[model samples]
Target: MHRARLARWVAGSVLLAAIGWLVSIAEAQEGAAAKAPAAGAKGEAAGRRARAGQLPPYYREVVSEEQRQKIYAIQAEYNSQIAELEAKVAQLRKERDAKIEAVLTPEQKKQIEDLRAAAKTKRQPRRQAKGNAPAAAPAPSKPAPATPKP
Candidate 1:
């Protein structure tokens, strides 16, 4: 059981990592598109070179203008293909999640949901405390017992 649970966690982590990578790529492409200039050959060429500047430090430094254009062209060529594959991956992931959810008994499903809610409640206070939460009121002090003959 522990092994199975661990395997699930590992798989989930890998999936999350892949999703994050794809999202970053998509954002990069979107940013490049937004920054690309309107019309002229000079503007387009500049845009391509600018996009190439987004490359890692080593590659960005070594690549020539010609290479930048080529790299930019290659990225443009694959962008749509990558987007299609990402969409397919998302559909497959949704189906996989539905199938996994279906395997759970209703009671198990409810139990997991309750566990999630409990976990969320546990996190909420910590988050609030981390933020600008108001200081909690001090508990009222008890009055000293009536003084005996001292």
Candidate 2:
């Protein structure tokens, strides 16, 4: 009779242990499910911010291997394009300045220098006002003055 009672107690303890494990598993699954939507929402917000030109928090750290390769490729392309454009612009400016030098007399060169200085002065206020103004406006038509009778 004591052996039988011992066997029943062991069986009951095993059953209770199994039940506790299952309850713990169920609770973990429930907690994970509850947290899933919050994680998804945060991911979506980060994506939106990145699209709007704001860097995600992860961007503050060292980039991953894949991202580093991508950045290197992009930098190489930009550098190539910038070097090409700078060469072209420098050539164009050289040509323009040479032409201007050839065309101007000494007096005209002095006048051109004065004009350039005046234009630089005038440009500052215009540049400051440019952001607030419309880019262009319609031209006004002028009425012809009265013509004398033939």
Candidate 3:
């Protein structure tokens, strides 16, 4: 019983250390292309974040060697399929971005890049008070001209 507990602890510690090392290594190029995502890519970004934020299968669990081997076998069986699908998705995304970029004017492309950078800087949601009402009625957007048409 004591040996099993010790072994689990050691495994958890090693797992955490490896994850930390990977994060540290990835930090260098984390934002190389943070800006300039194609339109509707926000949903894709959120999906990626949701996946990354999920707990791993068998996370925080200690299992026997046989169970671990079974889990690994299952993982190995699916990993290749997952990799192939991921590569195809990446290729599709790249082609989609290229098509969109091709249609944009130089000025429009620059504006999109600037807007993307600003969006990456922050995501601030509008705040509403107790009542869902505007602070005040906006002035007439297009007031009548002072003089009538001659």
Provide the RMSD of all predictions against the true structure, rounded to 1 decimal.
11.5, 34.2, 23.5
Error of 3 at 10 (Å): 48
All candidates in order of TM-score, best leading: 1, 3, 2
TM-scores of the candidates in the order shown: 0.47, 0.32, 0.38
Candidate topping TM-score: 1
Off by over 4 Å in 2: 1-72, 124-150
Candidate 2 residues 54-119, lDDT tens each?
Answer: 234667386876775455444443443456555755775577577658777999999988999777
Candidate 1 minimal-lDDT segment of 10 residues = 132-141
Q: Which ten-residue region of model 2 has the weakest summed lDDT? A: 47-56
Better of 2 and 3 by lDDT: 2
Error of 2 at 56 (Å): 17
Local distance difference test values of all predictions, in order: 0.71, 0.60, 0.58
